[model samples]
Target: MVKLTLIRGLPGSGKSTLANTIDAVHLEADMYFVNQQGEYCYQPDKIAQAHQWCQQQTEQQLALGHDVVVANTFVQQWEMQAYRDLANKYQAELEIVCCNGQYSNVHGVSALTIANMRAKWQD
Candidate 1:
């Protein structure tokens, strides 16, 4: 049996950090922001593609009988629902963690933007 962990938080939140501590196959779309020079580069037009890649990776890892962890800014329940479906499809145990700690610079996300995201976070 496999397990899937969905770690959600704002841009500066420690979602990725927490995912690392869990000893799972961590996946984060922000990784897509990285450029060939190993620098972070945010591309507005590629957000959907980044997410699609993450989803595909999750499925592949699950099919290989490995546990997975997804770290993303899932401020709304709907944003994380697809992972739930994937977990069910693979009969994998699913877990969700909401990281609320205030962090900055780790992803080059500004404090103001993180605050704005917090304000819009769904309950």
Candidate 2:
């Protein structure tokens, strides 16, 4: 059965690491920042576009009847609604996984930013 899994957590959590172990088309909005040289160059201005691109990629994979795993810091309930809608649209089994492991964030997100996200975390 095709499944759409959402892995959510703060930066430095194990979302990406866990996504890698899952047998699916794993995607993350942060991947939008990866350059052709395989370097992560985060642009705060392009965050919205990154998410849109992630959603598009996920939809494409789902349309092909493939399982998908999306890892992102979905702090708010609304941040995950789009994926939920996509799962319904494709009739795929949906799963939500939250990561809480404390590891160094690869993107160098500031402590303040992480604190802010924690404050707004819905669950």
**Model 2: per-residue lDDT, tens digit, 1-123?**
689999999999999999999999999999999999999999999999999999999999999999999999999999999999999999999999999999999999999999999999999
lDDT tens readout by residue for model 1, 65-91: 999999999988898888999999999
**Residue 91, candidate 1: C-alpha displacement in angstroms:** 0.6
Number of colliding residue pairs in each model: 0, 0
Clashing pairs in 1: none
- Residue 40 displacement in candidate 1 (angstroms): 1.8
By lDDT, who's the top model here? 2
Q: Once superposed on the true structure, which residue ranges of model 1 sit more than 4 Å away at CA?
A: none
Q: TM-score winner among the candidates?
A: 2
lDDT of each: 0.88, 0.97
